[model samples]
Target chain A: MSDLQIKDAVKSYGNVDVLHNINLDIESGEFVVLVGPSGCGKSTLLRMISGLEDISGGEMFIDGELVNDVDAAKRGIAMVFQSYALFPHMTVAENMGFSLKLAKAHKSEINEKVRRAAEILQLEKLLERKPSQLSGGQKQRVAIGRAIVRNPKVFLFDEPLSNLDAELRIEMRAELIQLHKQLKTTMIYVTHDQVEAMTLADKMVVLEGGQVQQVGKPLELYDDPSNMFVAGFVGTPRMNFLPAEVVDVSNTTSTLRFAAENGAPEVVLPMTDGKLAIGSKVSVGIRPDHLHFSPAQSGDLAIPIDVAFVEELGDLTYVYVDTKAGTRLSSQKKDGRHNHGTTGYAVADTTSMFIFDADGHRVRA
Target chain B: MTDAIASPSALASNRRKIKVPSLWTVLKWIAAISVAVVALFPLWWMFSVVFAEAGVPVAVNPRLYPTSFTDGFAKIWEVFEETGYLRAYYVSIMYTILTIAGVLLISSMAAFEFALFDFPGKNALFAVVMLSLMVPLAVTLIPTYLLVAQLGWVNTMQGLVVPGLASAFGLFMMTQFMQSIPKETLEAGRLEGANHFQLYWYIALPLSKNALITLAILTFMKTWGNFIWPLVVSNTREVYTVSQVINQFNSPFSHTTVDVVMTANFLAAIPPILFFVFFQRWIIEGVQMSGSKG
Candidate 1:
């Protein structure tokens, strides 16, 4: 097992840089999930670490040895590709044992390693089958088995579960977590799915536009996002941001005003330190689950909302609404009928509101 | 449910209304067979003439079948006794084998390089190879003959084999086939500690067997049947390939003896036919590889 370090790593194709100044330290036995949208250079970063791609700049160290110039095999890393890429002509046993055979390992040792991997993956019955004969999930298992046989210092997975169906993706996510625990090797997994990053990562790095947006524990980034991009990207159903203006300021509270009908009053945000100037623009951020409807208010601000849509997913309901300013809003509804129309409106209390300045930075108390 | 009760009467009327194309099917079969026979008649006629006596005229219209293989053999023996027929046959086979082998080696290696690697001027080099394919071999004949003469390879197998080795068509075909092989497979091998040579040997070479076989068969048949290049390159009977030497028995200006020439031609055709029979499976596989759905 080894810790992998990337210092000031950059990649450029000719003049245009695809990855810019990427610096990360993955400790031994840590599962670091690299989550990003497509074209964010996450896969390219992984490939550079794996030595499959040439690093355009900076140093890479694996196990305290600089490996920027090392070949993939010599780097002691294994990768499971999104396409599986199992040798179509080779049987499962042959595919699993290929690396060992190439290294000129003894026949008995090759068989022993292959058999153990097969047993762990429940692939003993599939040892005789070719890749074409296996289903997608089975082929992926064979791919992982191929990786497992190498027993590398680090395992790189490039969207390994993206090809699987939703149910299989969930099942395989658990299997991968279990595999990481059992092997306890430094593993870097790349995916676009936030759920995968949250569930599978010991540490998560979210990237956008070839740059790291934030790097921290999953809950840390979720609870406190540094910027607007990380805030909107790190959560499910996404954190909602509503546009508003500061109407009145006080020592402990500030009133944010938006156009409303005669029955709806303007919402006030109670800040620990009154920090806003009147008439200044601000954005209010809210986690959907933070919003709760109350008949009698005991706290700050309440805004009447016009419910636009509802998604009732058995355990919880997501209510899509428009604020009094006609800004689109989403809030989690836990009780009563899960309303599913645009016309019927409801009220959510002030604690749900997350205020931001004009720059989309969150306003923290 | 109501329709089920009335279906037998309705079905009887529907069956009466339907007109099967049994007569048209028979007519179509007749037309197809006629076309096939017309296409294959030259091959059949060549076989028939190969077994007829040299002096006896086949017929004004030609015989559908030959009299006997023994008569044809006797005439071919007469021709052989008069000239070095067996020697020519030996030279032809040797030259064809060498040419095919060299073409396979050169073309496959070039194709592998062109298909797999990205170096400086790789596309420009590939474009040059494609450009070579557009140049007619006939146009290069005189220059090739002079080059062979300057090299002192005239009347040698080198004259026949060397110039034709790096066949542009073979290179193009093999490159297209090798391109379809997923790059991931090669990457997988590389990650497994297989070096460049090992990757080519263990993954590329084995997987490209179909394309190689297709190129080999096509190259062999083409070299075996090539006439003008070998004729222009070789000055003596000692270096004549089967195609060039088979014309030696024909007296085009006089009363031509068909059987002696046909028998030699018939025997000359057997090697390529045998080659094709052995490698037909590879041809289909090659075509299928080229036809992969996007």
Candidate 2:
């Protein structure tokens, strides 16, 4: 295992920059995941770390040694691609031991390493099978096993679970977590799936427009997003954003009212910093889970809504409703009693509400 | 008893419906058969002339089938002894083998780079290569012959094999095929410490097996029947390809009978026929894939 440092890394094609000044420090044995939407340079950043793509600018170090010019093989990095990328003509054992064979290791040693990797991945019975004969999940296991047998300092996964079915993806995700624990190798994974990022990452890096948006522990980013983008992107069903204007500001609290009409829902949040001025426009960000059908306590803002739909998943139901101003929002309910086309109030908890200013930066105390 | 009788009638109706072909389907089959017959008639005529007795006027008789198969065998032996047909056969086989090997390797490597890599002027360079295909081979024949003579490759196997090795058609087809290989597969090889050449050899080549085989068959057929180039280069029988030796039977000074000429042509056509018979499936598959991809 090795620590990797990318310092002010910039990747550009001709005059257009794809990734800009990306600075990340991945500690040894840490499972770091870079999560973002498509074309956000997450895969590009992973390729740079693996030395498959040129850095274009800035420096990279592996194990505290400068390796900006090192070849991917020489960098001691192995990558598992989204496509599985197993050689179609190669057997499972050959695919696993390809790196060792390329390095000209002795045949017995290659076989031993391949055997160990296969055992770890539960692929012993498939050692002689070609990739074409394997199921999607088995192919992915072989891809991961290929990386494992390399004994590389770091393992890079470029959305390795993206190709599997949902059930298999979850199964593989759990297996990946177990693999991380068992091997304790420094691994950097890239995925557009936030659930995968939240579950698999020890340190989650949220990226947008080629720049790092937030980097922290999974729950830290989930509960305390640095920007509106992270607040919206880090959660399922996405966080709801309502246009609001600061109606009143005090030394210790700021009151915001949603919708321009009078008697709209209003909430007061603790803000000792006095950053908001009266009549200043801001967005109220609330997660689906944080919105409740019944207010737990007084002082929660209750917004009147027309129920658009309800998605029931056994113990919980997601109530999707449209506010009077026509902004759609989703509220999670444990009682699961909500129905379509019903008029009711969904309470937004004051303590859980996040306020972002006109620029989409989080408003903090 | 009434239900059983109704069942037989229903089954008979269904069978009658299935057995009758639509007029459009019949027309398609008729058109296809007409084309097949038109394409195969020349071959039938060649075989008929080869099997007819020596000095027999096949054009006058217009026989659709062979009259005497032994007559063709006797004429083949006569031609083989008199014209050193075996030597020409050896030359053609060697030329085809070398040229196919060279073409597949060179074109596949070139296609691998063209399809997968990015460098300055890549599109422009590929455009130039494709543009060369537009220029007729006959247009470049004189200059190419001059160059070959300057290099002292004329009258040699290299002269026959090397000029056509960098086949634009092969490269184009292989590039289209190679482009369909998933990029992640190559990158995986790169990460596994395989160099570009190793990736081409181990991954790209295997994945392109169908395209390679298609190109080999095409090159085999073309080089086996190659006439103009061998005629221009080979002044002696030592380097004469099968096509050139067959051309010897048609020369005005040779006084060779029509049956001997047709027999020589029949012998030259056998290898390509067998090659096609074996690998026709891959040829069709390669053509379909290249068509869709390109």
Candidate 3:
């Protein structure tokens, strides 16, 4: 059985639903990330699991026990907040041991536990300093230490690294992975950043508009996203979408063609999945890395585009172009032949692109 | 000169700084000193009268320095012999301490609940507290006195302290300060196994140190110097606070001794003055530091 299970969990404010029918099973010692854009209900779902929010409907189970009605403190779960939330007047050791102290544990036990956690986080020397005296990174370490001392079954991190500088955030990400490996505990982290989600999580749950769009391993989601939103939201220099239509259908095979604005020679690609009607509107999504320059006279499909600008990074280059279909697409290429203020053709291999139906659901199974 | 309308006084001050002794500067200094002297003259005059020897007429020109300093100590001795001077100090100190304890407990607890919790009727209840501030203390005096008498607390310390404990203004100030603390801090405490009272006692109270100190000073000073409540409640020498005994020296059975009255008054003002002198920094800096980000 999974260590934590959320079965048909729903959360709603007065009259409006934030998350509906959420079903998730977090295995023991798995690092899961709930990734979404702002207002996508990832934080709300994490809060519900933490018992900080009331689940409007459905049930939550932790370690095979129903915890929907349990108080947050008794739920045996620990969370690290984005703001650090260390008590200003308390020393770092006291803040870390506060939970054990409130439990009326023996003084020696509390000190030992706090010391162990401090050693893990390398905060033993700063035990006597108050939260106000510590730098931002140290404060963050103390917050994590506060959770670590609890030895909780599952750890919840609500964008714990969002407040740090970029370099520190990256450093802390590696530290957190090390922490997870050492503890061997189930951890659920919430973030709006796909890059952090991709780097940190063992599994990713993509959410949009309060609904879980997809859940899989990070690279699995990156390679084969279920739909348009996940496909676009998961990658950097995001996927490019162009309009396409089903031209003809035969037994177990169908031909599709692009709907370019300007009349241009096109290659009709045939697929084995014959689940398409003739002349149906569809969207074609292809990653910029998949696009390649073909011979001038011939390619799978030639896209007439106006080159707007080119970004020349030392290792790579991004060519931004406006298509004849009036869609702005950026292509990633390592060769930095950046012609300023010039028009160029953007070519693509048709079979590499994903085709979506009118409902934005993938059609090429 | 470039921004003439924006800072004409600044420009004038710059021009005046050019090694010039002008008549207006001397007159400005005179006006400022006059205001300061006017504000502080009563305390100086009280000391002067208290120090003057018994039945010796005060100087015609009110003096800033006391004419005879040792007589003030002698007059205080005489007043203590005649009236309940020592007993008055005891009553006043106890009354002030109890009053501060009661008010701070009630107000801070109420303020914490108001700041942290969501319940029905919270806003309406706070509004009622605010509305009660508009009612003058005099209007409630008779009813309060009757209630105290009915409770068999007449001439008791309770009558002097309890009725003035739940101050509306103190509750309002405390609640505003409590609200300024970040909500995440309270939530952290809650998740750390703290109940409502624990949250208030441990988290809210510790974080609100500055506001609590300022409140303690204000409430202590106000209760120590109170006159009307203790006057109406305590009818005998055993229960008289310092301020009540000071009132007794005004006439003392038809023979008015102005010097004794001044001496008693001077003695009574010492505790509150010393309190303010030591803690005046908290009263000002507390307000400034409150709600500021770390």
Measured by TM-score, the strongest candidate is 3
Q: Go through the candidates in order and give each one's C-alpha lDDT.
A: 0.82, 0.88, 0.84
What DockQ would candidate 1 receive versus the native complex?
0.66
| lDDT value, residue B15 of candidate 1 | 80
**Backbone clashes in model 3, listed as residue pairs:** none
lDDT comparing candidate 2 with the true structure = 0.88
Q: Candidate 2 on B1-294: residue-level lDDT in tens?
A: 255456787888888886678899999999999999999998998998888776564466567778887988888899899988999999999999999999999999999999998889989999999999899879989999999999999999899889989888888889988999999899999999999888998899998888888788777767777788888877788999898888788889988777788889989998888877887887677557656311
Greater DockQ among 1 and 3 belongs to 1
By summed lDDT, which 10 consecutive residues of candidate 1 chain B come out lowest?
Answer: B285-294
Model 2: per-residue lDDT, tens digit, A1-365? Answer: 89999999999999999999999999999999999999999999999999989899999999999999999879999999999999998899989988888889999999999999999999999999999999999999999999999898999999999888999999999999999999999999999999999999999999999999999999999999989999999999999998899999888999888876423557788987469999899998989998876422234788776778889887889988887878888988787665434776778678888989999999986
Q: For model 2, what is the alpha-carbon lDDT of residue B288?
A: 72
- What is the Å distance of residue B78 in model 2 from its true position? 2.2
DockQ of 2: 0.76
Instruction: Give me the runs in candidate 3 sitting further than 4 Å from their true place.
Output: A262-267, A293-298, A336-341, B1-33, B57-64, B67-69, B286-294
TM-score of chain A of each: 0.90, 0.96, 0.95
Give per-model TM-scores: 0.89, 0.91, 0.92
Ranking 1 against 3 by TM-score, winner = 3
Between prediction 1 and prediction 2, the one with superior DockQ is 2
Model 2 / residue A15 / CA error / Å: 2.7
